[model samples]
Target: MSSTTQKHRNFVAEPMGEKPVTDLAGIADVLGKRLVSHGFDRAYIVLGQFLVLKKDKELFVGWLQDLIHCNVMQASNCWQCLNDWCSEFL
Candidate 1:
């Protein structure tokens, strides 16, 4: 079987308590900083926005594109991260 990406494994490896958005895999340093500037400093805070969007893929993707210029893949990865994290912990 093929292995998962380090980003995927690392994110799923723990409770995300207080981890900064920058710490999330697939989020580049520039994007992470932009997210922080927009008041999404913590991973959990981004989780809040994810939940607020009710996990709708289109909405989430659109929001990310609008807010941070995230490409489709990056937005999708971030969405998956939050969705899986919620499934595990929320």
Candidate 2:
């Protein structure tokens, strides 16, 4: 079994429901603050971007990397979190 982070599991286990960007996996306080400052205060906003990117991993990862300067692993984690959420909820 893959060793998923608790954060990832928690976020994917339920509806996003206006959760803060920080609630997403791999988005810690610093990154969350950066996202908020850039007008991505909510998880849905990021999900909107992900959908707009057509759910392409590269595009979504690149967008997050560009927007927040997150490392590849961090971006990938966020991508996986959103992807799993979509799989369950959308």
Candidate 3:
């Protein structure tokens, strides 16, 4: 089985609380800072948008690509992270 990174595991392992978007796997400092500037400083805020998009993978991925220039892998990872978090918490 493919193993998840420690960051990914840690993020999905509990409540997001106020963790920043940068805290998610594949979201580097530069991207994180940019997201914050765009009003997505917190992980939950991003999650809000994910839900707002009706959890549509295409929309979420496209939004990530447009907002942060994230590649498919990066966008998918972040999307899965939030998706799993919602499954557990929301």
Candidate 4:
């Protein structure tokens, strides 16, 4: 997995704008393409799903794992990243 401290810092520090799904901390090349293929092409699109699920932590993490095969740590990192982004940005 890629280091997220920097990635997380960068992601939350600015408006998401048009950043792609891969810009998300846990989503590397393979997972980013998978997400795009699944119609989640952008970071905001995934965030939309997170909002659609009402920001439910377990549900979001479970969805990431079940749908994209994110491991436990990946899901956890993603969940925390998004949550913090929401706190700062939303």
Q: Is candidate 2 or candidate 4 better by lDDT?
A: 2
Number of the top lDDT candidate: 2
User: Residue by residue across 1-90, what tens digits does model 1's lDDT show?
Assistant: 124568766786799988889767558799999899899999889888888999987898889889999899888888887777777777
Q: For model 3, what is the alpha-carbon lDDT of residue 74?
A: 86
| Pairs that clash in candidate 2 | none
Local distance difference test values of all predictions, in order: 0.82, 0.92, 0.86, 0.85
Q: Rank candidates, TM-score, best first.
A: 2, 3, 4, 1
lDDT of 3 by residue, 6-77 (tens): 788889899999898888877889889889989999998999899999998889999998998889888888
Candidate 4 residue lDDT tens string, 1-90: 235688877888888899998888788899888888899998999999889989888999999998888798877777777888898888
Lowest-lDDT window of 10 residues in candidate 3?
1-10
Candidate 3's TM-score reads: 0.91
| Higher-lDDT candidate of 2 and 3 | 2
lDDT against true structure, model 1? 0.82
Better of 1 and 2 by TM-score: 2
Q: Top TM-score: which candidate number?
A: 2
Which residue runs does candidate 1 get wrong by more than 4 Å?
Answer: 1-4
Query: In candidate 3, which residue pairs clash?
Result: none
lDDT of 2: 0.92
Which 10 consecutive residues of model 1 have the lowest summed lDDT?
1-10
Q: What local lDDT does model 3 show for residue 21?
A: 89
Estimate the TM-score of every prediction: 0.89, 0.95, 0.91, 0.91
